[model samples]
Target: MADRLTGQPFTTRSEIIAQHGMAATSQPLATQVAIDILKQGGNAIDAAIAANALLGLVEPTGSGIGGDLFAIIWDAQSQQLFGLNGSGRSPISLPLNYFSQQKLTAIPAFGPLSVSTPGTVDAWYEMHQKFGSLSMATLFQPTIDYAEQGFPMTETISIEMALSAKHLQGFPNFAQTYMPNGMTPTKGTLFKNPHLANTLKHIAKYGRNGFYKGDIAKTISRYMKDNGGFLNEEDLSQHKSEWVTPISTHYRGFDVWELPPNGQGIAVLQILNMLEQHDISRMGFGSEALIHTVIETIKLVYEDRAKFYCDPDFNHIPIKTLLSKDYAQKRNALIHYKANLQVGSGMSGSHHIGQNLSALNHGDTVYLTTADKQGNMVSLIQSNYRGMGSGMTPTNLGFVLQNRGQLFSLHPQDHNVYQPNKRPFNTIIPAFVTQNDKPWLSFGVMGGPVQPQMQVQILMNLIDFKMNLQEAGDAPRFLHAGTSQPTGKKMTQGGYISLESGFSASVMQGLIDRGHDIQDLSGEFGGYQAIAWNDKKQVYFGASESRKDGQASGY
Candidate 1:
């Protein structure tokens, strides 16, 4: 009954191929919205921004204007990749001493205390200012109309919405905005937020000032003051997205790229650098050797991540040393046929590393990639952090403030420790790949720590196993969670493994024999989206994860 010729068993469909333009995103509506923008003569970056705005309205569980954004853009004209870090900082008024006086060991996951200045709007403005050809009004109008006219909630978003309502409903203005009539929305339910429509109108008209300096900024500041939150108008106004050079590591023949510190993107490069030593193709996909090697490699790099990964502006990160081939070789030497019970970071740290690994694995985020006929491609990831954010919904603003500050450590000496005007350690990242100095792939996986792990697997599937774009994403993914986190928690007892459903029983037994703690976990593998350039065919191949309510379409 199914066409099995071009697809793996797990692949729900073949990759979408198009010569003109392509877009892949977590929601079908959002994907279509991007295609619409491209059809309207917008570039890949413009379509990405428009689709992201629509996602904030349609899939608030994973993304919103309240979140932070990171992107890797492949500019066909320059033949160079660009990275944008649009993350925000903590309020200058709240110093580390405040947390000390409060005697809080970690920032709370939800509430005004965890709130940070939102950077999504500024990110949109920055991106549009640099590369956009269309007016802000043109890019945002579709989402504004959708927000007012309403869109049907997909099943995935519906489930997440119900879960979010349980924790967020009690917060100020959350119920009035999300849970209308005091009820959680179900699948196929049409939802509208006229307030969000108004907000989008302001953004479309006034660009960045509409959000960070005007009535919107005042409302946010007033809301924080009343709710005991630290974020204020000044914090919002001072927020800016920085354009940074993307860092890369050569794996097998292709160059894999990710953003530097402040975000955990480079961890993908670090992990790939370690795995480069192994001849994984011979081991085969889903084999004991390959899975074990990948899992172990992930553990090795994540150790370095916890100790070294942070905002480079605040602390000097040993990027050159960590990504050095010599360093990877030394780390790879520590891996063997059996799981290493005692794993430590490559670097020495004052705080204990890998001592008490946190079991928290899930994160709420959305990833999308778009390719234009001009050969430009954009890989973008956005998140509200911990799902639906801090629950600090400003009145009539129609979006919650991000709780990203929760990732900051209370340890004063830690690189990611809470500080005035410093950004919290961000988990969201965007990734890209190039071959022979040409844009090869624009892709990303969205989950907490799962982002880097899944990203590494995707590259391996493509380069090592030669799987097609769709098959590469649909392949069974293993999540090796509980590595030391930026929040100052360490992994203990070698951490554990959560295998996806597609792995064989023998492979499961193989991991168990190797001293791995194989356990069943609710699927947290991650949602993926990608667009690859076919230099020969002169077309684009797009793929979206089957596990998500997403679509990959082309014109």
Candidate 2:
């Protein structure tokens, strides 16, 4: 019954997994947890929060309650998407002169100074208060159980644990908790964190006060005091998440949406607009021409991003001008074939306008997308900035705080310069797309600068190449790195575009012949998870990237 050459029968067929309601996440258990919540009468928002909590437990390297959260919720009842910026601000006590006094050229990556007040907890409470149908207690119990009772660790997490163990060895109890045996465990190992369980249990029962005002707050403040961190009880108590409107740009008859600045979601829209001028479908995937165009287009977009994107509260952001078709056209005029050009920011017409940006932008992160039977959908992403975060574990609280401060620039006039109680430009953004005022796709790819690039590729794969969700995610991707740093870092010589393994040798040479710098690499492409609704069929299709250990299913 099997075709020996292609192994047809035995091989898994990558199809759009269809169901009445669907869930897709970077962890199989998280996806199952979400579906369970939906089946129990919870809406997409409820399932999303539940799934995110579980993901923190199952994939601690990529995320945890100690990090930040950004979400885009598709509320079927209201028929509108909601954006929440759950990112925290830098310490108020740390003024602009702090870095100067410390003789620091760049912000430190680890310890107290790097930690922003944890925002995921506040985000969870905000979203739940607005949309959750299930009790918070009910939603958190499963993850608390998993954290309390040891669960089998996945291979990828094990590898990450071993890699990050050295940086974490110095943090209090990090070694004792994560590496009980004084060394990171291998795959198939059982790991547990009763400390995290207690933390979640307290939050579930007492809500925001449990984490922000009580023992949790005390623990964080004490750790900062003892370790030269500026965070205090005041900072914890003052923490709040903002609800904002989502922005959009039209592409090929569909409206792609993303959260505005302090997020690079604007850059994603800019990239789509720049590439829209080219006939991508005709050029095709893996073509040197397509790759060259995208790389150049992204370079131009990021150039504007570095100089303008920042926290709007701290800077004047010309959101409208940056996303204007005129701006995209102006940037698109810079692309030159056969020569890798170093690009920077462009003015929005005759006037200089502010752009959107985020910090702690690069990180190991997790994305979850959910859709319920009622047509409600959610695209949510959370991150700790870097793998294992800032390596600063508070006394016995059992989670790493994000190194978001690293994104703050020391340049006095920079839009993203260090500021008291100001949120950094955030990189972990969730995205959704709608067509004709109806929900289309809810998806996100997790990585630092790679997120926006991967997202564009996914859309192009689906729209231009006509690939199914699974195929789009599985297809080989091109990653351009060291391109443009919005934080004011000087542009390096020339950034290289890395190609995944599946590209033919001729394609590789073809890119080089076009004066593009190419590299053979593995593992920088983002982990993608998405759910698309087909209104005509009245079914939902889910997809999970083959690059990650994840699952996508519907019911």
The numbered model that scores best in lDDT is: 1
> Can you give the lDDT of residue 516 in candidate 2?
72
Residues 87-201, candidate 2, lDDT per residue (tens digit)? 9888878787887889976677777778887899899989999988899999998898888888888887778778777777787767876887788778888878888889888
Q: How many backbone clashes does candidate 1 have?
A: 3
C-alpha root-mean-square deviation, each candidate? 1.5, 3.4
Residue lDDT tens for model 1, 366-419: 999999999999999999988889999999988888888888888877778888
Off by over 4 Å in 1: 1-3, 7-11, 353-359
Question: Which consecutive 10 residues in model 2 have the weakest lDDT in total?
Answer: 349-358
Check candidate 2 and list the clashing pairs: 306-486, 309-356, 309-357, 310-357, 358-425, 358-426, 359-425
Query: What TM-score does candidate 2 reach?
Result: 0.95
